[model samples]
Target: MKKEFAVIGLGRFGGSICRALAEEGMEVMAIDVDEDRVNEFSMIASHAVVGDTTDESVIKSLGIRNFDHVIVAIGDNIQASILTTLILKELGVNKITVKAQNDYHEKVLRKIGADHVVHPERDMGRRIAHNISSNNVLDYLELSDEHSIVEIVANEKLSGHTLIDLDIRAKYGINIVAIKRRNDIIVSPLAHEEIQTNDILIVIGADVDIVRFEKKVMG
Candidate 1:
């Protein structure tokens, strides 16, 4: 069954999400206050409407509660975004995702019952900075303020060493969650599994510990 999704705001982030969802064969309702933006997406989205999302009556009339997921992507206008989210929650929308401009905005959205909040620009900037800073670090994802999941290349020092021989978990407080060699992947790799020179390790642990592991093991 195709899932139903509503994307509010026609800015870069929201527009990209709406297009991708529609391309994936999902039922998408694209909403925005700008008539031009609505016209731009009318051909791609299942439905497109130019309406003020902050108005509860406008939202209810659109039957937004019928959607399985509603993404509040209002840009610049924090008040409109917060009010729309609050109205959606009150109307019993099944799931609500919101894009927050900053930490303060995220806190407010959380307090108002946003199911998920994303800081796309901040998170993307962090990832780009990490990749540029370290050649060994291929990718980095911040799970929380203290924890992260990282993908690093196995170096000569780690090559041919099994998980038990390295004692990575005990020493660095990080777990080798998965091993990726070329196109192959081994999930929850056993202690006896050997690391190849070019293997990619997907490790999960505290941010500090991940840095420690990267320096000691792959530096």
Candidate 2:
């Protein structure tokens, strides 16, 4: 079954998510206070409505609680975003995802019952900084505040070692979840799987442990 989602904002982040969800064949209800933004997404979304998200009656009237997921993406206006999130929670929305502008915003969202909070701008900046900082580090994703998943090229030092020999989980508290070589991808690689020089390792672990693993193994 196609999951139903409501994106409550028409700015870049919200609009992009609405478009992507619609493109993936999901039902997306796009909401915005701006009539122009609503009109722009009418053709792209399952439904588009112009309404003030901070109003509880507006949300209830639209039956927003029925959506499988609701995203509060109101930009710039922190008060509106927080109030909307609180209203959605009170209305019993199954899942609530909020776009937080900063750490303080994220904390507030979490306190108000947002199931998930994203800092898209900050995360993008971090990715860009990581890419510019190291040629070996291809990508970085924060699974949690302390945990992360990273993609790094296998250096010469790791060429012949198998996962069992390295004992990454025991020594570094990290797991080599997968390996990507050119066009090939090996998922949940076996303990005996040997590492080839230049192969990309997709690893997951605590951020500090990942750093240690990268320095000790990939360095």
The candidate maximizing lDDT is: 1
Predicted candidate 2: what Cα RMSD to the true structure? Answer: 1.3
Candidate 1 residue spans exceeding 4 A from truth: none
Report the lDDT tens digits of candidate 2 across residue range 1-219: 889999999899999999999999999999999999999999999999999988999999999999999998999999999999999999999999999998999999999899999999988888788667776899999888788889999988888999999899999988889999989999999999999999999989898898887777667
TM-score of 2: 0.95
TM-score of each: 0.97, 0.95
How accurate locally is residue 76 in candidate 2, as Cα lDDT from 0 to 100?
Answer: 98
Give each prediction's root-mean-square deviation over alpha carbons.
1.1, 1.3
Which pairs clash (backbone N, Cα, C closer than 3 Å) in model 2? none
lDDT of 2 at 137: 90
Q: Which parts of model 2 have CA positions greater than 4 angstroms off?
A: none
Q: How close is candidate 1 to the true structure, as a TM-score?
A: 0.97
